[model samples]
Target: MVTNKNKIPALRDRKAALLAFMPAFLMAAASAYVPMEAGLVLPVLGFTIMAVFFGLVVLWWQTETERQTLAMQLAGLEQEERVPTAPLVLRPPVIVGSPLSVLRELAVSASAQEVGAEIVLAPTERVQPARFPEPSLLPSMRRSSAEEVSRMRLVTQAFEADRIELHLQPVVSLPQGKIRFYEALARLRLADETLLSPSEFLPILECSGRASDFDRRVLIRSMAIARHLVARGSEAIVSVNLTAHSIAEPGFLWSLAGLFDTSPDLLGKIVLEMTQHSWRHLDADHRAALATLRERGVPFSLDRAADLRFDPEALADLGVRFMKLPADLLISVAEQSDGRYAGPELDVRDFASALRRQGIRLIAERVEEDEMVPKLCDLGVPLAQGFVFAAPRPIKPEIAGEQTASRPFGLEDAPTLLRRAG
Candidate 1:
């Protein structure tokens, strides 16, 4: 609308006018120097060119004037209507060295020549965007840090007092719910006899570089339990959770190696478990340590697996005989993707098949509901562990301390032992 109302001198228009003027001026100059007969034609041509140029200029000026008058009338009518209006204040373009500068100068001149226009000027200030106090977690986070410190001190005290106890959670075969394995978890008994679960104290242990110590204690207890089970003729495997820190520590490995050498029989019944993160990020040294353990007949289980993604062949080669994932994760992955792989094109069912083919059994952990069992079974998941079967129970102190003739322990007697134990 503004462009139509304004007679802005365009480059093309200026060029056309310059061209017309050049021809007229040349014709007039030639007429002054030529003979009467030839001069007569030159003057006539010059006159005709001037007439056309004048007519074009008059027509353009008249059109622009009419447009300006109409715009002004519309503005007056709008003002009478009492509509709110903001003055269109044009800012001077920044003086940059280029063809743009020249264009800006021309525009500025044209705007200055514009008549009966009011432009309100505001102070030219660089607007700094609102600086919101950067999302602060510092105050609350510091308090959290202080709380963690206090917890760390308590956990340290517990470790020093040797109040740590071993708790076992059963991993059972789905549909049948037979206890196939028991995952050993360390529970710290505080001064007031408050038992701290792994979820509460494990992170503190890991952060304080005491994870290997906790894992070592857990491993020893698990081995002890495994021996008892094996001696009693039970085929139940006891899985001990180990950390990458323990795996990386030469001292821990040496101690484990010594254990393996002393009680070679315990190796078959004792399975070492590590999180998926630890398994995926195993360094060359970690792998060498793991390989050494594998050679000693100590099988590995991948615990707390975050996803369904797995290379069963690779894991099998790594001596990872068991892969424990959450039951909900399995169902969600299958249902959301319609049994298809969330990351790869392989089917969810095929993953279970592949794991089985590679001798890697898929055990869904945290199966806290009966409904999860059918979905897991449908997905070809072989085993599950959670409160749906049984909450984790502390091993009987007398059983752990038992040194007398081993009471004949077997798969059928497992539940009785669990019930009789803590």
Candidate 2:
């Protein structure tokens, strides 16, 4: 039976060889007949047919030999012993204590060393327990009462203390541009005559629920400074920050109208920076109050416009004329690609474009790097503010009028002077 199977494979190979030669045999026949019918020389036709027929037979034999060699190789592989593979070994994970436990152990060790020795307790001496002083009868320590007390204390002290002062930071225009405005930042002059930045105290004011009162005081002082600047033939706009509570107050619009009435000229020069967070807090009624102010020609700018959550569309609907984007946003974009602010790098491009379509001006706040100016300008941001442009400083007439006129505003100027005033 094995011999019969081998013979069957050999017969199959021979059949395949014959099939492969059939095309060559057909070509030889056509060549022989065509030459014979044309009455060509007998010897030439016979030699040509013979050469073709033999060439095909040789090709068929070579193919069959290759097939047989491959079959032998495959049969040998089938009979070969297989190599066993090694089993995979998985190592146990290392155990480690939590950071908090490690810290606690270290703290205990440190405390034990610092204490030097443990104390041995002796028998306690018998003595009468001293009567505690009667708890002072006062208002309960509820959040509302505590807040009211804190607010009263802050207002009282602020009014009594002469430390609170208004510091003006000049916000200069672009290259060879005029001094358009100065932002009025609140400064606290400590008892030592050292200046404390608004950042340190502004949070305390907000936490104490006294932001509105603080805003009122700042507005009053800033207006006084605005009047002073206007009297000097300076048409610089004075910008003031308003808290969300102040914006929501029903009488705030009226209060602003009264301020404008006192300093009529200040109306044209006053710019209120309504922060994105503050604007979000305003309900329908509060927004109506804002609309009333808008009708009165008080210009408003949306601060931190780069905040993704800040509704640019809504702010535009509210007639917001100016928007301030963070400086880092512009700077990072410029640094990444050929100092050009475009594509994904300019994330607020869509918002800026939307606002620009409505004729609103985009202001890039904190434009510290010099390289960023061209890119910002390219991005259609006409106004740039940062230490790179001009540091917030106490408004000196010469510095405000002349320094701004002579040197291009730079970020380097901000740290030296901004620390002095802001």
Cα-based lDDT for every prediction: 0.70, 0.59
Can you write out model 2's per-residue Cα lDDT over 217-312, one digit (the tens) per residue?
778777777777777887777888886555654677567766666766667577888877666656567677667677777778888554444545
Best by TM-score: 1
lDDT of 1 by residue, 1-422 (tens): 12334555433345555654565566667668865685577668768677668757855765665567678889999888896444454554453333455567667656755643454455786544332211210112233565566667666666755566777888888678898988887777655455677767666666567878777767777778887788788899998877665665556765777778888778778888887877876656677777888899888889877666777778898999988878786787688746764656467767678888888888888887888889888988888888888888888755554222222223222221111122
lDDT of 2 at 294: 75
Clashes of each: 0, 6
Q: Candidate 2, TM-score vs. the true structure?
A: 0.52
Q: What is the lDDT of residue 21 in candidate 2?
A: 61
Off by over 4 Å in 2: 1-159, 248-250, 306-313, 333-353, 395-422
| TM-score for candidate 1 | 0.61
The per-residue C-alpha lDDT of model 2 at residue 127 equals: 37
